[model samples]
Target: MAKNNTRVRWVSIGLTALIIIAGIITAFLQAQADIEAVNTKADAIVKTSEVMKIEGCLPSRANGNNITRIDTRLDSMQREQRTAFKEILRRLPNE
Candidate 1:
């Protein structure tokens, strides 16, 4: 009877310690996984924002170039009309 009691007590203590160690390891692994997931999500968000900014800026830059071209054409047309008007007025005065 004494032999059984002592062996059983030692076995109970060993099992309890093993269970606590396993729980601690599992918790640490879970925390590491959660931190990695959050970091991945943050990086994605930043990349998406950078892409959107680039896309948005390009269209406005194109629009500014288009505006400049339109202004140049308008100036050329105006000069042509002025020259034509001057020639017509000269002919009418001579007649």
Candidate 2:
């Protein structure tokens, strides 16, 4: 009877160890997947930013200054007006 109890205790301890190991492996895999997903999103955002710059959808830098010195809302309004003026100019017939 004592031998049987010892065998049962050993089996229980082995199962518990395996369970803990499996949990660690699962957590590590999940962390790796999360990191990969974040990297992919960051890459996609960089690509989109590049495309927007190429298409002139992003803000243009000042001729002399290297930084933006105005309010963002005001700058956005100005850009909208500029785009509207360009569209109007394109629709105008040549005299």
> Please, what are the lDDT tens digits per residue for candidate 2 over residues 1-95?
99999999999999999999999999999999999999999999999989988766334533343345556767999999999999999999989
Count of backbone clashes for each model?
0, 0
lDDT of 1 by residue, 1-61 (tens): 9999999999999999999999999999999999999999999999999999999789878
Candidate lDDT (C-alpha), each:
0.93, 0.87
RMSD of 2: 11.7
Which candidate number maximizes TM-score?
A: 2
Cα TM-score of candidate 2: 0.59
Best by lDDT: 1
Q: Model 2: runs farther than 4 Å from truth?
A: 57-95
Worst 10 residues of 2 by lDDT: 57-66
